[model samples]
Target: MNRKHFLSSFIAAATVLPTFKTLANTVESESSSFKIPPYLKQGDTIGITSPAGYITLEQIQPAVLQMQSWGFAIKIGDTIGKRDFTYGGTDEERLTDFQKMLDDPNIKAIMCARGGYGFVRIIDRLDFSTFQKNPKWIIGFSDITVLHCHLAKNYGIASIHSKMCNSFPDDWSKAELVQIETILSIKNALIGERMGYTAPAHPNNRQGKADGILVGGNLSIIETLAGSDSDLTTKNKILFIEDTGEYLYSVDRMLWNLKRSGKLKNLKGLIIGGFKVKPDDAGEEFGKTIYDIVSEKVKEYNYPVAFDFPVGHQRNNFALKCGANHTLTVSETGSVLQSF
Candidate 1:
């Protein structure tokens, strides 16, 4: 072959090779490391426990009856009525109850009774070896984000970040009942389509579409887990965060923790959920709003960013499957979240 022909061919191959490599890496990033735990069926037993604060059986009786009405049996944990100050039980007792539920083969899922501030205390002491071998859904939000992150980061098992036993209503509304049933039922829970949110457009919202595993929960819990064994790896993954009642300065501080620690450096997308922040005091001023704090920190990323996602401590809180691969589409019109 002529020298000119050889040089031109070599340049073409060099340019083509990087494009192929980039495509391959993209495919690999989107591949699943997540396990979808077996969903519940009729007559399946759901073990309910208070892994955080104290709650009387009277408070949860409505939910228990509701579950039975839906053809599921409720297994109440010992911690349900026990009180040791603010928590249902001591750390040891709570951990034991949780471990028992985790190892119980008949318990198809474990639903948290409520969320307070005790999960981070016992999270490290609990064993998941047995649960890993026979995986089932672990459900809750708020403080339960600890368990969700632990399971996702260490075991790669998907969990429900939704309303807990305390949130279940006795007089169920049609829409609320449907949401609860959809996440608990076996077939549909694993493969059903997610109801998307139509968020009000914000100037800070970034426009684009992305696909990756969804990993995040309460912003405070996530911040606490940072740099730990169970901390999340946000690279090439979509993150959704929410928190409530925190001071504005603390919220800004947590956002900086995520940014400076390199957790927000790479991502497929970001979803900002309901932040029911506390109002500033009479004389104090935090200066920036929640949107201002977040947008400034994430200004460098070009990935899709959706604000006011309908998940968090609110009446409209929607269920999300942590560790599941999802397609996140954000536009000026709104956003859609779907599992693949």
Candidate 2:
């Protein structure tokens, strides 16, 4: 038997443990068995792999130099700059490059070059054996949410849902830089405190405290992951969801699906991000607001649902860690989620 088992046995025999205490001890020991990936230390090399969207050579230098400014070396993947159709390369090529990076002992981190689409096709083909054992930070949001959801669900490796390579336009601002830095900070596993926005509250609120594995990403992709093992089960979880340019009814349908399937009913907290809501040049309101849609779907539930956390498809968004434990605070001042 393993040393942990042997020691637990020895302790049980010597101490004559109570039944409830023994069960609690075992549950604690088993549930906490999941591992945290090694924090990114300075000077270690980070690999830039385009697991989804394609990136032009023109788009590469700024992302590279950004990492350089942080005093770390970057190792570009073979398929990073290749443009075979809509992806950085063929599906096979993209998977191969990702596998190569995961296989390399020298690569301490993997950052997606961008996130447009094309990851759901290749998620099942990924070999998570090594990744499960040696977890490293996988960074990016949007289509990159596929990788984040896959890694968090299968390998129990926490990943950041944040900025990608193309997020930084030429006309960048200091606020955007700070947002990206918050992401890179979490990439290094430097989760400090419950840092978030100062927002107002909703009418239907489920107060009190509960904590569990934090998980979520784009609403559409998460809905698609339902029935699959990758779906985030909100038995006790702070579910963070965000999206952009999606019609309000589309959001309503997806949330309705999640509601119908019993996914969003038991959530500990619901974090709605800055929706980037805009009326087009024609000045159409689309008949439904994102807030109304969410409130409608979650009306029956009593969970503390807070909106405007600033962690979705917008600039200056906060970083969130899946598979990490967090405490949620909801009040008139707003909700602040602190990760420990």
Candidate 3:
């Protein structure tokens, strides 16, 4: 009840409140910070492992030779030439191989050999404690989306969403220009070259410009991860998605899931990449084009939307730096995405 005592207590409370607020802000900043792994240099090593599908060592030779010509060493994992039904090997074998690559400081990057139907089986079992301390580039797409999303959600680490060993041509001399360019993009990303990509204009595009962190991968895999630890957080981010061999209805359903889960809202921009739709069953038709499905889901949002971006299961799939900041511009002429 004394004035001096009351004033002292008020000052003490005010001092403690500001300290608590500062600590809370620091924790939030650390949790959301994005990390880019060290770029590769000449003589650096890249470890190749099959975390998803099976592929023979012979199948990966073309990629090995090509990457070697770029002046980097290659480390083939034990899962190469491994088979366990549709998987690269027993789940344990694949996990151990990938874990070793993560722990090895000499291995500067990891390239998943192919994408089929694994990764999720071993994602929880594999420890990322060492990986968090020593981050490295993880490269692949399709099924490898699981790893990309997991890294983005849990660690704020960047990864490459690109073609794998299976996509490499046996003879580069005879390969198409697009194929060569797309493959070269991977090397460019690893060495930390600034990336810029443009897609031809489409009537479906909504013209605008925005800048934000880029995050997304195969649509189906993203849908599969909803509510899990690996689920993507797309707020204030440019989201680019692609998928293959899904029915039109399925693609629509996945987009709906994204919309319902708040992934489609609060986006800086949206890039719709290649979607190879399976034909409808003879008697049953799901009457909606890919554009229609996407437009309906994103109609209310004001962010830019670009279609036919050069990424996905096709040969034109260029490497993307997930969890990195990028600017996307959609104009009547075309759409350009530039990575910083």
Candidate 4:
């Protein structure tokens, strides 16, 4: 991506930019996508590790027990026992723990306890050969988006973008169980799935279908990888994005950056998860809800765009696939997501 493109897009605050022809380069979307790792069944062992931040041992047990109760055998990564401020320890220590779990054949899944911010420092150093050869579900959200993109893109493997390890897991709300089951099934995704939700559709929703590998995570981290190898190419695909701790204007800016970089041009569909909600009083800053900001800016396109699919910063975060093949459907009643 051209950093200059983002600057131009941010200033105009709209879709005013050069054409893809100007760039004259095309990155082909990989169609033969990989299968999402199967869901954890009874007797499967799930490994718990703190790769991005420090988690107190006392608090860690509860999270481990939570998984154990879910019928998964649990193992704690070595560095889950270490601590350095808000992190599990040195970058090397975190990397070792993560790699150990990733390399272990006994562990059916690797779940991070939390995501604060530490993976970037060690992303390039960690070895994923074992994982690529014998892939399993890698789950977490928030700052952990870093790992999702890295694992999905580099290895052409599937990973879960869902709740991370916490003393208090996301207890299901009264009406969210159906969506919750849909998300959990992603670990063991079956093809030709359908998932939809009630939403005020944009007039630009061409009322058609588009298929591509599902990609995207926290808006902040997605922007950070804009020009790097890990920076995902959104051509011919569905992009799901959500974030927290950002102003409404910042949300607009990142979407602009995505547009200018050609990330938004050829997208098949756009799924907007909950944006970072901050503590605020009664007043509208942008005079537009986050949904409005996204709809207005993205409406100019002719692809299907769905909002509020129960993913991201919200409490009942659904596990989403970052690089798996999926079909996106949108209509007045709701939206349907069919994973391959």
What tens digits encode model 4's per-residue C-alpha lDDT throughout 1-340?
1111111001211111121111111232445354455455678898888888887666677557656666678888877768887788888889888889988999988888888988888888887766766778887888888877776556556677777666243454533544345344333321212222233455434355777778888988988877765677677778888899987777778888988898888888988777766544457556557876777677678998877656777654656656666678787655666554
Q: What TM-score does model 3 achieve against the real structure?
A: 0.91
> Tens digit of lDDT per residue, candidate 3, span 56-76?
999999999999999999999
lDDT of 1 by residue, 212-311 (tens): 8888999999999887766877788899999999999999999999999987888889999889989998789889998999999999878999888767
TM-score for each of the candidates: 0.85, 0.81, 0.91, 0.79
TM-score leaderboard ranking:
3, 1, 2, 4
CA lDDT of each candidate? 0.77, 0.66, 0.86, 0.67
Task: Give the top-scoring candidate (lDDT).
Answer: 3
Off by over 4 Å in 1: 1-32, 173-198
State which candidate, 1 or 3, has the greater lDDT. Answer: 3
lDDT at 38, model 3: 78
Clashing pairs in 3: none
Instruction: Give the TM-score comparing model 2 with the true structure, all chains together.
Output: 0.81
Best by TM-score: 3
Q: Please estimate how well model 1 matches the true structure, expressed as its whole-model Cα lDDT.
A: 0.77
